[model samples]
Target: MRRSPWATLAVLAFAQFIVVLDVTIVNVALPDIQTDLHFSAENLQWVISAYTLLFGGFLLLGGRMADLLGSRRVFVIGLALFGAMSLLAGLATSPGMLIGARAVQGLGGALLSPAALSILTVTFPHGRQRNIAMGVWGGLAGLGGTLGVVAGGLLVDSLDWRWVFFVNVPIVAVITVITPVFVRHVAAARAGDRAFDAAGAALGTTGLLAVVYGVVRAEPAGWSSPEVIGFLAAGVILLAAFVRVEARAKAPLVPLGLFRSRALSTSSIALGLNGAAFLSMFFLTSLYLQQVRGDSALAAGVHFLPMGGAAIAAAVLSTPLIQRFGTQRVQLGGAALGVAGLFLLMTADAHGGYATALLPGLLLFGTGIIGVGVPAQISAVVDVQRHEAGAASGVVTAFYQVGGALGLAIVTTLSLSRTNAAVAEGASHQQSLVDGFHRGLLIAAIVAAVNIAVTLASPQLTPDAELIAEAAAVA
Candidate 1:
């Protein structure tokens, strides 16, 4: 059965938007939720991190499941679970209930995200059609993050915080109804014999959760504490074991050999680094605007409009630049822009004017992310076999989510360190917050710069460059 590419794209894109939307939507409402739920300061991040930890941890399994099960079946199942969990999240009466629901929601997201991408992978075969479809996919993913901040602020101000979760139901419902008519079902891969790698899945998920838990807890407890060290050590050993198991498994959750592709390997690193910086940008910036500048959530959302617009523009510009200069050049340039943006952001003071200090940095950051993200994503899955695309896409998404987990942990730790130092030195709360933000921004900037250097050094682009060189040799 034939599927309308348009309808399939819409379904997948919308699904992705919901998945990515959750990442930023909660940020604008964090303060409100805290006040109402009596959330402890340390526990505040878990509201977001819980979702990320589960989503990131299980993404590989989800991708593999899509490969084992049918994509259409997985898509529908994932959508239903996510929608139901979203509703549950909206109705939560306690912090534990909310966090539990969020973890479930992330589980649903883990299922849906890879399925959505797999659908896209199958719907558009290779060449121009696939490229165009991927562009839309990439664009929507970035757009979703920007829109989340805007939508979260609007909903929080106009109605209630619960509306953010409730909003997904209508969108998911619409897609659920339309997808069957528009998309065709594909059979599962090797349906009879292969059992899902339950043991591997357990080890991988537990390992990641422990690592993310330790990272997020760093700010609350000093890094040297036994608890932090224990969690980190256990996570590392478990993950190493998971890797070893994957090497020998008959059907590994993530194919260890996929990393053999230069394109895939470099792309994953680039995306991970891009995510590390990009994910933290909004959290830090929004906090600065609301806490220091005293902007309302709505006002902060509006303030981000330029950044959003710049990002959209940058994504639009990426295709042409990538075609002309190639992925390597474009990515390197984008990373440099990100570094510059972070440097500019660090120049902002508590009293700094928005126009002179803030907007420029926001614009640069937005542009950098768009430029890096799209190309990096394209490179990641470009070389994989058709059957392996789902697994490849899952790996890319996992890198992205884990990057967020790590980025948040680092930023939180730095913020706490700076804040503590300021307090010990007799600075006011507002002043300490400013100091923390400044330090965080600087650290993020340094990270971005290192990513830029790493991207420049990546061995993948060397092949493409060699291809060009060989062509010249023949000429």
Candidate 2:
């Protein structure tokens, strides 16, 4: 199963693009989906939530499965499942059926996402080549959300909303067929550790599921509601227990030792902040465009185009920056750009237009965000052992997912609260909407600012630094 690494990266990166793409593509198609499928207003949110929740919930488990079962095997199975679920989701006759299919699709995504990264890390090793591969992968991932909205709009307009789901079918079909032939990587790198830890898996998975569920429900149900409080409490306790179990397990589902690496742990925290700031910025900005500026969904999506372009450019330049300067310095510079971008976004007025209000901030934010993700991701896998690569990937991915959930909950609550307060004070509805948006975007900016400090204090290492260290040790 030997193959070219570049060929392997293309296959893996495309699979990842679809997974990230599905996250937002469905949002544009939601109204169409609801109208045709007779979805009630309340249950409509599940169309997106079900996939994200399950996908986030099972990431660790999926990563472990890749280690236990083998990346290639899990990859093929996950790809097939994802493709079939997409077909089922597209052809769904009822809301319940579509939700069910999406839930399964989430599991498939959970499996595939990490396995792809696991294979990439193992295939490329960690160096200049890895950075370029990651640059390509990260660029697609960052753009996927923006493209999803644009693509979803086009799909729903030119074709049907079902095409959003249907589009993934042929892509995965091609990848799945050529995967065994082209993705020459074999079983988990940790081939000798055959032991399983069922207890850790149950506790950790359920803990994460409960936490994500609580955050998702918090905005709609109120954070203080019994349901939210109960879920959050249970999640905290379950995760605590899971940690205890992992500490004692001879074969820990997630090796507690992995966190001992300053690089991995710091990157995990940094990435969580990255997700909170960046993902919520997208959510809030979309609302600003549609609610404040009165753009159509398609038009609102079009506004992200400039940001997407800046991001692609930044992603391309970042690898060489990492090669010369190291990940920590690059990440710090990105944070500064991101903070400046967020601050600029805060100045957006209720009466401002696209060129006057959003374009500047969006361009700055987009450029900075590419800087945010690329280095942290590169840092995350630094010195990670081969066998546990999947699990490491899962850990960082899960943090980002949960961070997004938390960020959305925080900003949305702040926005609504601010808007309500403004309305009570007799502000016009439009003014209140603007006030609320600024409040949320400001909070996102603050989060990005905090990351600058985090990146500055964390471990600093790059491919060249490692070589220097090795040479020094040999000398």
Whole-model alpha-carbon lDDT for candidate 1: 0.78
- Give all candidates' CA lDDT scores: 0.78, 0.78
Give candidate 2 misplaced runs (Cα > 4 Å).
1-10, 27-50, 88-103, 118-146, 177-192, 197-201, 216-222, 323-326, 383-391, 420-432, 462-475
Q: What does candidate 1 score on TM?
A: 0.90
Worst 10 residues of 2 by lDDT: 466-475
Candidate number with greatest TM-score: 1
RMSD of each: 4.3, 4.6
The sequence of per-residue lDDT tens digits that candidate 1 reaches over residues 1-475 is 6668878898788888889888888888877787788876556666787788788878878776777888888888888888998999889888898899898899889888877777876787765677667667766877888888889999989999888899999988988888788877867887575568767878887887788777767777778888888999999999999998888888788788999988778878777777778767777787788878888888888888888899899877776676677778888889999999988988888888999989999999989987787667666665666556556767777887777767776776776679779989999988998888888887788778877776776544323433322211111
For model 2 the local lDDT of residue 430 reads 86
Backbone clashes in model 2: 0
Task: Write down the RMSD of candidate 2 (Cα, Å).
Answer: 4.6
